[model samples]
Target: MQTRNRVAMSRRAFAGSLGALVLCAPAVARAQSSGVVRRNTSGFKLHNWQDHFDELGKGIIISDTNSRVMQQWMPGGEMFIYPTSVPMTDELTRRGYTEITFKDPAPDWTPTPSMRERDPSLPAYMPPGPDNPLGARAMHLSWQYYRIHGTHDTRKIGRRSSSGCIGLYNEHIIEVYDRTPVGTQVKLI
Candidate 1:
């Protein structure tokens, strides 16, 4: 009887301690974990594009690098997930928000200065075709040097092998390209 009472008390103590720990965490931690933001303002305030998903509507793309998934929120609240190759390093896929600056069907490929420095063997440029890294479609983002494009290698989809740009399968990118227009916002998280 004494042992049972002690066990009950211990459980209650653990529950109380867990509650306290959660309460003690910073508001930002809570906000990020919940993917919800609360604003308090009497004057003008800077808004984070990530927090206003609904306002952005159909053109919003949320890339979860950890999960290797690109979720597009279409107008009227319809969401679609496209498997993609996310970058391995934060430097490659910097966290931020940007809008699509341009869209190209079968975009030409050119190794960036940084890319060539890393890989000396890469050619200077390759015309849009099956051999091109930027497969069937590409969407350039306002974040300089970053893009969402299709891959010639379909096996790379849903993996972490990209230099920086997010990559989907050729056919999948065709679908995304058909739907996503220029000026669509993309948030890499």
Candidate 2:
């Protein structure tokens, strides 16, 4: 009789667990469909240079805000892609054509007027160092106060966290800064 009771209890426990799974299946499916579930590193979409550029003039750099990825295409069909941190909001984003006006290997930081307006406590200027927000390198764009630079804060990558600049990892920015020259065509979309 004890053996029969034990078997019955085991079957009851299994049935309860199966029923709970069935009840939760719809919610789990809904969460996945709604994008609550995400995979790391596979979210970026590869883009064709021809689709966005007339030609790779001085090579081209494309920063896609939606995917949080940046692509660099060299003249000889060489291409490199890096995850980036985009502007925090649509209002802060500046899209369309621009070019690299300058490249700074050891960049200083000066908060823009708007940046200062947003945060009054920001310093008037910052010298280059690990603590500087521009990290190890910076590529200035034609647009005022905009840049493609590195961040000491690695958590910012693959997220919408920047004020207006496109941000990369420190090591990645060093590589990009070395490869990209002044006057390289750029587009943020």
Q: Which candidate wins on TM-score?
A: 2
Q: For residues 62-112, could you state the per-residue lDDT of candidate 1 as single tens digits?
A: 777876777776565455556688886777877777888999986998988
lDDT of 2: 0.88
Query: Taking the tens digit of each residue's C-alpha lDDT, what string does model 2 give over 70-180?
Result: 988888777777889999999999999999999998999999999999999999999999899999999999999999999999999999899999999998899889989
Candidate 2 Cα outliers beyond 4 Å, as residue runs? 1-41
The residue pairs in collision within model 1 are 58-75
lDDT of each: 0.76, 0.88
Relative to the true structure, candidate 2 has a C-alpha RMSD (angstroms) of 9.4
On the 0 to 100 scale, the lDDT of residue 164 in model 1 is 94
